[model samples]
Target: MSRLSLHRRLAFYGAAAILLALAAAAMGLTWLFGTHVERRAIAEMEVQLEQVLSGLTIAGGRLTADKLPMDPRYSRPYGGRYWQVQKGGETLRSRSLWDETLSIDGESAPSGDVRIYRQRGPGGTPVLGIERTVRLPATLRGGEAKLTVAMDASELTEARKAFALDLAPSLVLLAALLIGAQLAQQVYGLRPLKQIGRRVSDLRTGRASRMGADWPDEMRPLTNEIDALIEERAADIERARFRAGDLAHGLKTPLQALLGEANRLSEKGDEAAASAIESVADSMLTHVNRELARTRMAARQSGTQARANLAEVAGRVVAVVKRTPDGARLEWTVEAADDLVAVIDPADLAEAIGALAENAARYAEKAVRISARRAKSKLTIRVCDDGPGIPDEDLMRVLERGRRLDEGSVGEGLGLAIATDIAEAARGRLTLEPGKEGLCAVLELTAAGT
Candidate 1:
C-alpha cells in the first residue's frame, strides 16, 4: 500500500489498466470475428439453397434435384454440408445428409422467403442453416416446397478458436509496448521531484541558497512555497541572532564597569571586597561570552557555507596562546597537516581551538601539544597537555557551563562548554579523555569535500 513509491504505484495502475483494456479488446475482436464467420457461412448456405431450388423437378411423380451444388462435401455422406427439398409428402436431400436429416421447427412463413436458424444436422451435431419455401410453377401441379442448406456449426467454433490463437501473440506484444511506455512516462514525470529532493539536501548542507524556479508547471507552486518558507525561516533566524548579539553587547559594558569598580576597591585597600566583586564580574563576563559563542554557532547552523583549514586555525590559536604568560613557559607542539580542512566557519574553529589551547597552556607542567588529522569524512583535532587530568567522574561535569574543578583558575569554566556547542552545531562532537601524561581534548568536525 502506502509503502509503495509513486513510480511503483503508477506502474501498477497503468499496467493493470492496459491489461484490462487488452482483455476487453481481445474479447471484442473474437466476437466480431465469430460474427463475420457466421455471416459468411450463412451467405454460402443461401447460395446452396438457391441451387437446390433451381434443380427441383418432378420425376416419376417424386420430387428430386437434377442439379447438385459443386462442393465435393455434398457428394460425401456426413461431410457437414447438406441440402434438402420437401413438397407434397415427397422429400429430396443431398448425398451428404445420407439417411439423417436436419431438424427444423414447424413454424409457418411466406413462400420464397429465406430464413436462417440453428438446429441439429446429420450425426446430431449443431449446424447453421438457411431455409426457404418456394412456390412450384403451374406447368407441374402447383405446390410449395421447403428448401434447406446447412453446414456444421462446430466448424465456425473451430475457426473462432483459431482466430483467437492467431490474435494472442500480437495482443500480448501490444500490451508489453503499452506498459513500457507507461513506466517511461512515470520516470520522466517524477524526475523533477527527485531533483527537488537533492536541491533541498544541498540547502540543508549550505551548498545551495534557493530551491530555484526551473520546474514543470504542475510543480511550480509547490517549489515556490518551499522556497518562500526557507526565506522566511532564514529571516527569522537572522533577527533572533541580531537580538542575541545586541543583548550580549549590552551586558558587556556593565560587566566591564563592575571590573573597574573592583580595581578601585583594591586601590582603596578593601582586598576581600575587591576579590568578591572581581569574581562576580568575571563570572558575568564568562556567561556573556558563552552566549555570543552560541549565537555564532546558531548562525553557522542556518545554512552558511563554511570551510576552515585545520592547520591554519590550529596554528593561529597556538600562536596567540604562546603570547600568554603561562603558555611562554611551556613547550608547545603543533602537528596538523595543511591539507586537512573542516566544514565549519574559520572564526568559530579558531575560537573553539583557542579555548582548548588556553586551558592546556594554563595547566601544562612542561608541554602542550596540538595535532589534527582527516579520516574519511571527519576531521579530528586533539589538544593534549602534560598536566594533572580531571577524574573520569568529573569529566562530564567539566563540560557544563560555569562548572570549575578549581576555583583558583583564572577562567570561569565556559571554555569546554562553548567548544562543545560549536562542535555540535557543525554536526560533530567534543570529547575529553586521558592522554599518556595529561588531559586530551578531542574536537571532531565534519570534513570538507566529503
Candidate 2:
C-alpha cells in the first residue's frame, strides 16, 4: 500500500485504540451477565428446596410428605426444574428427573440448611442442584432424610452467546467511522503546505516577484523573509545601474577634449606622432567602453536569480579562456562536482570567476586550477595560478576600483574591482591570498535551496 500517508496512519492508530477499548467493555459486560445468570440460577434452586422441605410432616409416629405447592410445569421431563427426597434406602423423585435419579455424592447431607452443587441432567444439560436433610419428630421415625432440587442452566449460556453476537457488528462499524473521520481531519490540517508549494511554483515561473504576506501564522515569517531578500536584490541592482551611468557621464567631457586635441595635432602634420596620440585616445575609448559594458551587464542582472552550478560554470569559463591566445598555452584544471549550486546570478558568478581566470592566464607559468566546495551554508570558489604571487601588502589594495599593480599594462585596470562589486551586490565576499604555488582568488556565496 506504499505505507499510509500521515493522515491515514494517524486514523489507523486511533481506530486501533478505540477497538481495544471496545473489547475491554465487551468483556466486562459479558462477565457481569455471567455473574447475574449464575446468581439467579442458584436463587431459583434455593426456592425449590424450601418448598420441598415445607411438604414434610410427622403423623402417627411416621414421617410423611404432604401435597407440595410446586408448579406442575416443573414436573415435566427436561422442563429445567426437578426435586427428589431420600429416606435411608427409599427414594422419591419429581417427573422432571426423567428416569434419572439424583445421586447423593456427599458423605452426609446437612440438616435444615441448603447446599448447591453442579451436576449433569439426563439430557446432558448442566444443572444447579440444592440438597438438604432434616430429622422427623419423636412421634415419627426420629431419623433424617435428604431432599434435593435442581434446575437446567443451558439457557444462560445461549443468552451470553447472543449478547456477543449483537455487540460485534456495532464495534466494527464504530471503528470504521472513527478511522474515516481521522483521515479527513489530517487532509484538512495539511492544506497549508500545499498552498505554499503552489506559491513557490509561481515565483519560479516569474509570475510573482514575492510571496505576499497573507499566510497562515506558521508560514508568515518564512514568506516575509523571502520577500525582503527580493526587495534587497532589486535595490542593489538599481544602485549599480545609477553608479555606472554617473561614472560614464562624468568621463565624457575629458574623453571629448582628448580626441579634439589629437585631431588638432594631426592637422598640423608630424603624422607619426599624431597617429600615436590617436592610438592612445582610441585605447582610452576602448577601455571606457569595456567598463561601461561591464557596468550595464552587472546592473541588468541585479534581480537575476539563478542556481549557479559550480563545476559547470567553472568548466565553461575555462573552455572560453583556453581559446584565448595566452590562455591556449596555460594548462587548466577544474576540481568540483557538477551538483554544487550557489543561489546567485549565473552571469555575475561567471564574470567574477572569469576575471580570476584572465589574471591567471596573464601571469601563470604553467597551470591555472579552480576548485569549489560547500562549507556550512556558503559555497566557496577558488581559482589558483602557478605565477608570481602578489605581495602581501598589495593583496587587499589590488581589488580597489581603477587600481592596477602593473601601471605599464593597458586595458585591464579594473577587472578585479568590477568582479568584486558584482559579488558584493549579491551578498558575497571576495578574497585574494598567496597560493601554494602562486596566487589564489576566493569567492564565497550562499548555497542554493534544493
Candidate 3:
C-alpha cells in the first residue's frame, strides 16, 4: 500500500470528523425547528378553541353556534381551520367542514379538560386539533359536550423542508472553507522539519558547521543538541589527531636508538647480529607508522566531510611516486576527471591513494597506471601495475598487516592494510584484484554532491 503524507492524512481524518459533526448538527437543528413550529401551531389552535367556546349558546336542550369564530379561514369552505361540537349522537360543524368531518371522537374529554392531537380533516389535509369538554347551562340540558378546533399540519411540514433546503448550501460552503483553512495550517506547521533537513545537509557538505538558532521553542532543544554534538565531535577529532602525531614522534626516537645500536654491532664486524637487529627495528617502525596513519584517518572520518578533488589528490601521489628509484625505470600514467569529487578530507585521501600508487610503482616491471572516476554516489580510484601480481590465493592475505607474499620484500607488508583501514573508517572499501597485466588496487568512496 502506498503511504499518505502527513498533510493528506490529517486533512482526510479532520474533514471526516467535521462532516460527521455537521451532519448530526443539521439533523438536530431540523428536528428543533419542526418541533418549534408544531408548538406554535398548537398555541394558535388554543386561541381558536377559546373563540369557538365563547361564541356557543344553549337553547331548548340543544346546542347552537349563534356566532362563529372570527378566523376568516373557518368561514370559508374547505378552510384549513375548522371546529366541531358533539353531544350524544348529534353534531355541529364549521362551514369550512363542507361535508367532511374532524376525527375528535371515541376519546374522553372530562369536564373542563382539553386535549390536543393530530388527525386528518376536510379534504384529507393533515391537521392539529384541540378538544375540550364543556357543561351546558343549568337553564337548559344537564350534560357535557365536546368542542374541537383544528388547523392544517401540512403547512408546518412544508416549512420544515424549505428550511433544510436553504440551510444545505450554507453548510456546504462552510465545510469547504474550514477544510481549506485546515490544510494550510498543516503545511505551515510542518515547514520547520523541512528547514532542519536542509540545514543538516549543509552541515554534511561542509557548507555549514553548526545548526543556528532562532528556531521555534519546540525545535530549539533539538537544534541546540545537534549543534553541541557537532562541536563535541570536532573537538574529539582534533584531540585524536594530536595524540596520534605525538605517539608517532615519541616512538621515532626509540626506534632510531635501536638502529644506532645495530650500527655499532656492524662496526664491530658482527654483520649477522647487526642485520637481525636492524631488520627487527625497521619492521617495528613500519608497523608503528601504519598504525599511526590509521589512527589519524579514523579521527578525520568522525568530523565533517570536505569535498576533495579525486584527480588532484591522485595526481599529487603519482608525481611523488615517479621520483622514486623503482618508478624511475617504469612508464607511469595517471588519469582522472578534473571535476571528480568525493566526500573525504584531501590529506586523508592523498595518504591512502598514495600508499597504493607507491606499492604499484615499487613492484612494476615496465609500467604503472592510476585512474579515478565519480559515478553517482560512488567514487572509484584504481592503481594498476605491470608487476608479478599476487596469486588469487594470496590477494586477501596481502590486505592484512605484515603478511608479505614474498618474504624477501623490502618493507613490512602494512601498506595495503593501512589503506584498507583508512577506506573502511571513511565508510568505503579497498579491494585487490589481478588485472589483465598486473594487480589492480581498487579504492571506492562515496562521492559528494555536485
Candidate 4:
C-alpha cells in the first residue's frame, strides 16, 4: 500500500475537524436566530390582535371594525407585515393584503380565546389568527358572531434571511482562523521528527557517527538503538580487516620456508631425500591452509551477540570425538548448565572446545572434565583431564604458536594456537594451569548482559 505523507495527513485531518466544528456552530446559530425571529413575529402579531379587538363595536345590530391603528412597518403594500379580521364568515383585511382575501383553514374556533394558523393573501403569506367569541350587548348578539385577528409573517422570513447572510462571514472567518492555528500546531509538533530524519541522513553520509542523546525523551530510545547498531557493525568490520591482515602475515613465513626447502632439495641432487622434503613441505602447507580457514571463520563469527553455551559446545565436540578410536575409550563429563552462555561465537567456542577435548583424549588416562562458570562479566570454561598435567614451567610455553609439549604427536602445532588466537580476537583469554591430577586449560570470555 502506498503511504500518505505525514504533513498531508495532518493537514487533512485538521481541516476535517475544523470544518466539522464550524458546521456545528453555524447550525446552532441558525437555529437560535430562527427561534428569535419566530418569537418576535408572534409578539408583533399578538399586539396587532389586541389592537383589532379593541376597535370592535356593534352599531345598529351590525358588527363593525374601524380602521385600527397599525404599525408603520405594515403601512405599505407588502411591506412585510399585515393584519386581517373576520366576523361571521365575512373578512376585513389590511390594504397591505393587496386585494386578496384572507383564508383560514379548519373549523370556526370555540368560545373565549382561540389561535388558528393559516396561509392567506395573494403571496400565500403565513398568518396567525386569534379568534374570540363575542356577545355584543345582547341586542346585537343574534346578528353578530365570533371575531378573528391575524397578522402576516413576511417580516420574520426577511429577518431570518438577513441573519444567515450576516452570520456567514463570521463563521467563515472563524473557520479560517481555526485552520491556520491547526496547521501551525502540526508543523511545531513534527519538527522533532524532521530533525531525526536529517540526522539519519547525516549518519549515512559519514558526517556523524551517532545521534547524540540530546533528543526528547520519546525519541531517546530510538536514537540509542541506532547508535548501538552502528557501533556493532563498525567493530565487526574492524575485526575482519585485522584478521585478514594477521592471517596473511602468519602464512608468509611458512610459505617462504616451503619454497626455500624446495630450492635446497633441487640443488642437492638427491632424488629420494628431495621427495621426502617435498612431502614435509606439502604437509606444512596443508596445516597453514587449515589455520587460514580457522582465522577466516573466527573473523566471520565475531559479533555483538550473546555468548555460546560452553557445556553445549563441549558436548557436541565430545560426541564427534567419540567416533574416533582413542576417543571411544575416554570418558567425558560436562558440568555446565545448558542455558549457560558466553560472549563468544558458537563456532569459535566449538572449535576451542574441540581442540581441548581432542588433546585430553590423546593424553588422558580415562576421563576429562569440562566446566563453565561466570565471574563478574566474564565466563570461564575449564577443561581438566586425569592424565599427566603440564609442568608449571612449561604451562605458559604451550600456548605459544607452533609450540607443543609432545613433539611426537603428528600434524602441525596449530590446534591450541588457533583456538587461542580466536579467543584473543574475541577479547577473551586462554591459559594453561596445573591441574590436581592432570593439565587444566581455561578459556575465559566475556558474558553478555541479561
Per-residue lDDT of candidate 4, residues 295-357 (tens digit): 565544433333576777888988998888778998888898776777666777887788777
Give the 10-residue window scoring lowest on summed lDDT in candidate 4: 298-307
What TM-score does model 1 achieve against the real structure? 0.83
Better of 1 and 2 by lDDT: 1
Q: Can you list the residue pairs that collide in candidate 2?
A: 61-139
Instruction: Tell me the tens digit of each residue's lDDT in model 3 across 53-160.
Output: 777777665777777777898889987888998778978899889887777646766789888878777777878888888886764365777888888888888989
Model 1 gets an lDDT of: 0.86
Error of 2 at 166 (Å): 3.9
Q: What shift in Å separates residue 372 of candidate 1 from its native position after superposition?
A: 2.9
- Which scores greater on TM-score, model 1 or model 4? 1
For each candidate in the order shown, give its overall lDDT on alpha carbons.
0.86, 0.77, 0.83, 0.73
**TM-score, model 4 to reference:** 0.47
Between prediction 1 and prediction 3, the one with superior lDDT is: 1
Reference-based lDDT, residue 182, model 1: 89
In model 2, which runs have C-alpha deviations exceeding 4 angstroms?
1-3, 58-64, 67-69, 104-114, 133-142, 168-450
Deviation in angstroms for 89 in model 4?
Answer: 4.3
Best by lDDT: 1
lDDT of 1 by residue, 1-450 (tens): 599988888999899999999999999999999999999988888887888777777688766788889999998999888988877677788899888777698684578787888877788799888888888886546888788898989999999999999999999999999999989888888999899999877666655667889999998899899889877777766786788779977887888888899899999999999999988887777777787878767765764456889888888888888898989899989999889988888988998999998888878999999999888878899999999998999888888977889888777788888899889998889999999988999999887766
